[model samples]
Target: MIKKNIYFVPLFLAIFSFVVIAVALQLDTSPEMIVGDSMQARSFPIFLMILNLILVAVLILQFYKNQPNPIPLEKFPTWGSMILFLVFYVLTVFTDMFIGIFVVMFLMCVLWGEKRIWVALLTASITPALIFMLFDLVLKIRFPRGILTNIYYG
Candidate 1:
């Protein structure tokens, strides 16, 4: 039955990616808006969808070969990590993205059994700083205004 197949998730993802690719192709982009040799609005999303499909194919092949799941279904921590990602999203939407990153990183480290509080705190602190430096300074990209970003940019 379909419920028993290990490959179902990847197969379903692949099919969904195909649907997304089809939809992405329908996105309207003005010819005048595209600079010479520049990618269209839909290009990056379609590319990512194609990449997802390729990875799904690889996952399907791995499943067909009977490779054991790396994280067993019975592992509560693994499921908790998945839920934590949802929490991260909600926090990012309601609060600042950096705050979400800091909270999630610290919580995830502790959830995964990190014993050292200092190490977890360092991870929570350093990651957002590094991300800010990379995107704001190195890449010259500006993040949307938020609690910390407002203070920093102001």
Candidate 2:
């Protein structure tokens, strides 16, 4: 039913979060004296891990609570949408982050039945731009600028 499929998304997220946490745990998080003892590199990962665990716990609890009330399957999107999402996600690894996210978000909105073109465009553009600004400007993290970026600068 729709309820069951709905749960799959959260379950997948929980699993993915756990995987991230596992990878984070393996990172050398030891504090550098230059950065100070208060700024242990591991702190952020540990914080993320804790947050993920909390989310997973909440998801599991919700899954149990909703298991008895499954909705009809007719409400669900076509299975191909999920497959497409996965495909795009993998492809994004090889593409520019911003472009990949914009394309994917637009396609996903259309695939999941967003009817308004303007809304879809806004969602696609705004979301990725916000993420880029947050990571690049605020967090000082770098993102791969794909071929288009090089061409633009040239």
Candidate 3:
């Protein structure tokens, strides 16, 4: 049945994600700070990995209970889109947050999205700006200052 295939994608993705996270959790990292704070850097990744594993199990159960032979192929976010999404995430590692967000937003708008031109531009501009303002202004958090940081906050 069509529904059977629909379940396959999430199931496969969940399994793959679980394996990747498990391996990452095993890899060792040196402590950046010895402050012994609750907000340690490695905490989020470990928490998310456990959460993802639980979600996958739940989805697998739902698939078996509802769809007899769930096939997950009718929908296509496509390999290229997935790769680009990953690239966007990876890009954040090498660059400042503002530049990284803007690059990813513009690419998503121009290459894959369906909004009107002005709308896409607005999204590319406004979303990152708001995020910066929220983190920088509201939360008073430190972020890597890209070119705009000089103009906006400097």
CA lDDT of every candidate: 0.85, 0.72, 0.69
lDDT string for model 2 (1-154, tens) is: 4355656766777778777777877877554666664766656876887797788788768777767454556544567567767767676677665676778788788888899989999999988777777876899886665754455345
lDDT tens per residue, model 3, 1-154: 3465656666787777777777766766656576355545555666786787788788778776777653345334365566667777666666556776776677667667555878777887899888877988899987765555656667
Alpha-carbon RMSD to native, per candidate: 7.2, 9.2, 8.7
Weakest ten-residue segment in model 3 by summed lDDT: 68-77
Clashing pairs in model 3?
4-69, 4-70, 4-71, 5-70, 5-71, 5-72, 6-71, 6-72
Name the lDDT of candidate 1. Answer: 0.85
Clashes of each: 0, 0, 8
Higher-TM-score candidate among 1 and 2?
Answer: 1
Q: Which residue pairs overlap in candidate 2's backbone?
A: none
Better of 1 and 3 by TM-score: 1
Q: Which regions of candidate 1 deviate over 4 angstroms?
A: 1-74
Where does the lowest 10-residue lDDT sum fall in candidate 1?
Answer: 1-10
What is the RMSD of candidate 3?
8.7
- Which numbered prediction scores highest in TM-score against the true structure? 1
Q: Give the candidate order by descending lDDT.
A: 1, 2, 3
Comparing 2 and 3 by TM-score, which wins? 3
